[model samples]
Target: MTSALPDVARHEASDIALALDWVGMRGIAIPLVLGGPEAAPAAATAELAVDLPDPHAKGIHMSRLYRLLGAFAQHGKLSPGSLQRLLREMMESHTDCGSRAARIGLEFHLLQQRPALRTPGLAGWKSYPVSVQAMHRDGITQVELAVRIQYSSTCPCSAALSRQAVRNAFAEHFGDAPGITRGDALDWISGHASLATPHSQRSEAEIRIRLSPAADTLPLLAMIDCAEMALATPVQTAVKRADEQAFAQLNGANLMYVEDAARRLRQALEQHFGACSVAVSHHESLHPHDAVASCATPGWKRMG
Candidate 1:
């Protein structure tokens, strides 16, 4: 009875006789779990495709690819090894149709609980956007991982201008009053320190790195932590009055332009990963446009 079913995909020849680069599914929703101490199931969107190298073939078997993805969703732990295995399986499943290459992409958010800057026992969940890509071509497999980290960037120029304004205010108030005491200065600052305020905006850094073939597990949390530490001004999730004050202090201490941010991230990530690409964007609060900077190590090939 099974043999009576139509197998047109395997039996028929293509009318167009044109080879295609890729043919398969996209926007497939699947459950994925990463390998780590805190790993748990997370929802991910996946794209699975294989190259249609044979111009004479009618079409590749779509059901085989879907079933394999379904099986991975059920029991697979996402890692460089696992993704490579999945891509190999994808290519094998299409050998009858002459597929020579395959690739899989996964996009998801990794949530982490972060503590407040100065508040004890206060924390909140922060979500970071992450993506993983694995490609098998010409008997070689390459895997890449990328993550986006949100931070706060205070404009260095704005900070300097604001400081000058405060200094001018202080001189004006004290130029005529020669007998001013420390208490008087403190009181004046308390009353008018914010006469001019530095402009700060939320910024984001995207780091993409090629995974080493010997890598066994995804390094999502480690990379996130390293990037955040390098930036030194990650946006706070849970903030009390004290935490807000601490955040303000951090912004004032680490005033940076977009170039500064890109350099900081690129230098740190390069040290950690040997080579990496970093792109940073500051959503400008002072203007109608954003300020952006990017840098990559030599010979870095970004995944598409």
Candidate 2:
């Protein structure tokens, strides 16, 4: 025997006349597909949300949203079409509430195999912070991808000071020899390079891209490459003594401040994605707080 229960969501009316902008679940423990159609997808933790524009309805059909998300989770891929379908179903399911839009925020650590700087036989795993956010409204859908990549940031000021100290030391030691031999200079540099090495700290770049709806794939790996390649000193996974030396050399050549790092990432994103925003933070070792900078898709608000 089944007991009769009244469905309040359908039968009851809202006493309060205020309409809400967004009403739905968040941080739901559901898995999502990462990567694209061609690559093997990885699982992700997702937070889902939907908007309600009506003031008369008491609530919405939450289970339908969950079920739609579950169906997408079954696939090993996420594409523009799939995302649009989810958004459409969400609004249709809660048509009584007159829901107009939906949003999905995903957080996950993506893994990539990285080879040692010097050894071909040695390789290890590196994880990067990845997030994808999407919003659908007024027949317009916008998808944004954010990736965090860690690297080494060396101070140019420190490098200049180190060079001056080295020059002073050389003058004090061999000033009388009108000109020092290459061998002597090499000896001094080899011994002193570590003595006054420039300060470098672990840094990360958080990049976000607004994808075109016409785009099919997620382009996760390509987005990663843009940040890593611009920085040129990505944090190593498996490092040998030789690898350490190579990393030191890289830092020496690419010394940058937080602002410089932001500009570099911006240029890289502009060259690749055409329209995007970036907020890069260089966790400053010299200071107590992190150094941050933000860049956006030039004239995004004016654009349709």
Best by TM-score: 1
Question: Given candidate 1, what's the lDDT at residue 16?
Answer: 93
Per-model TM-score versus the true fold? 0.96, 0.92
Instruction: Estimate the lDDT of model 2.
Output: 0.79
How many residue pairs of model 2 clash at the backbone? 0
Model 1: per-residue Cα lDDT over 1-304, one tens digit each = 9699989888999999999999988999999987885488888999989999899999888889999999988988888988888898999998888899998899999988999998899999999999888899999998989999999999999989999999998998788867888899899999999999999999999998889655778888889888999889999998999999999999998999999999998888888877888999999999999999999998988764
lDDT of each: 0.90, 0.79
* Colliding pairs, model 2: none
Error of 2 at 41 (Å): 4.2
Writing each residue's lDDT as its tens digit, candidate 2 over 119-205 gives: 779889998888877788898887777888899999899889988888788788787886678998999877875556567789888
How many clashes (backbone N, Cα, C below 3 Å) per candidate?
0, 0
Which residue segments of model 2 deviate by more than 4 Å?
1-3, 35-38, 177-180, 301-304
> What does the lDDT read for residue 50 in candidate 1?
94
